[model samples]
Target: MKTSPYGAIAFRPDARRLTVSAPSGELTVWDTSDPSRPRPAGRLRTGRGIVAAAWNPSATDLLATVSNDGSGALWRLRDDSAPEGVARWAALPDRPRHVGWVAGGSWVFSMTGTGRTSVWDVGSGACVGRADLTGGRPVVGAHYRGSEVVAVTDSGWARLWRPGRRPSEWVRLTDRPVSACTWSSTMLVVGDLDGQAACFDAEFRPVHTLRVARERPRALACADDGRLVASAGDNQAVAVGRDGSVQWETYLRPPGAQSITIAGDLVALSAGRPRPTLLALATGAELAGGRS
Candidate 1:
């Protein structure tokens, strides 16, 4: 399917399909049944530009997207039909960075780049709890499992919060501002624009700083097999083993690599602009599939 230049994308946990929200305000879904020849299955056009989009971990059909225009929208989508846009939610503070579903899909979490994160009940659409991040700090990102929530801040700190209890003091790590962060198994991967990707052992302590392109984008993913950490950015791409050794890297032009995802040894790297081009994860092989 077609996508805007390096627009944010998310692979469904089931891996049956992937969803991408492009800068052109089009959301496309890809059918991964034939991995080598993934094709478009659906498309929905939005009225505003998209900064980021994510799938609800608890409910696959439920997706949330944040508009760069200071608004957030939720959609309930299905196959062979138009996606239902379920009411528009505005961002009064004018900075909603990321969104996700919580409370068994009964609540929604919207975090801004300016240190304001709020949880809204799905049915009533009323905020149940709000976390004021203060100090000109932005929430790096946030993830939820059951009742627990883990959020990282721009100041290289992570916090765990939920209904009740004082928001825990920030767990400081470094002075670097985080670009992207993700968790897998028991390890949480934190990446920065300074070309450092560090792994923390649950407690957010430094286990190792995995290496890749210098000053790369936050395109780091842990292989499900726990063998390699693949990252791409800085106009280059590299994969390092868990023990911290280079496994594969692109020597030619970087494909202008934007993000990296690992499903087994096969890596999927997205590069290019306008309509981004996706390259084979391993060997930096290029696939000529035209943008939809």
Candidate 2:
């Protein structure tokens, strides 16, 4: 088996490729046409700890990477003319802790630790507008609910905003802090410290609540088709159906699962057991005979 130190993992939207981030400030691309045998394709050096990355939806070859040095850069992965330099970069006042693409990848949004979310033009690297989320509390997480970006504060509040527009429509999901969240075109799912995963409709109305155990769910993932939801905690992982019924649950061995991502019909888990594991999205059956 081959292994390397990776901090985060994301599959391409088409499920044909996988990207992994290393703590040493580099990205490794893997060919996942054969999920059973992921072959390393290439690597991109970003120069610092790569905290987050997002692949453009419309342009599959473009990627955005956020560094620990309070900077963000856009890279054209398949560009042969300039293989070393990035396409664009924007230096911000504070370190961008979270990032995602919006407006069909034409714009990028970044959030900082102090509760500020900034929108940037992908091609020009200009800060188009900013949202002050620090209205007295720090933002714990941020997500996109359709075309609007929602910031979840540590105080159990969620607010929606758009690029170059004012934030509106405030809602509260719980009294405890949210640990993880994932979104669909018509719904928003959040995992809280109380070991409960809640689902909301397009209008932010509570629709379903799922609780498996007492442990906090640190990782959450949702299928793009909005048919499956997955949550991983210290020692267990659970997949739920759209109707809020538990589809399947698997208990991880030892140090337990550290991250999770759902793509197509597979749920990929990065656990502390040295090698990642793949499970069936419908039944949680261990894939590849329990190996990755």
Per-model TM-score, in order, reads 0.80, 0.85
Q: Cα lDDT for residue 129, model 2?
A: 80
Each prediction's whole-model lDDT (CA): 0.63, 0.68
lDDT of 2 by residue, 176-202 (tens): 777777776567777788878788887
Off by over 4 Å in 2: 1-6, 78-86, 212-214, 271-276, 288-292
The prediction achieving the highest TM-score against the true structure is 2
Candidate 1 lDDT by residue in tens digits, 1-292: 0122555566665555556666576667766545667777776555367666666666777777766666777877665566788856664366466666666777777666655667767678776777765445666667665554567776688776685555667777667777766666567777787777777776778788776546745467766655666666665667767777787776424455555555433455455533334445555564423244
Number of the predicted model whose lDDT against the real structure is largest: 2
Clashing pairs in 1: 267-281
Q: Provide C-alpha RMSD values for all models, in order.
A: 3.8, 4.0
After superposing candidate 1 on the true structure, give the runs of residues whose Cα lies further than 4 Å from its correct spot: 1-5, 103-106, 145-148, 175-179, 251-255, 262-268, 271-292
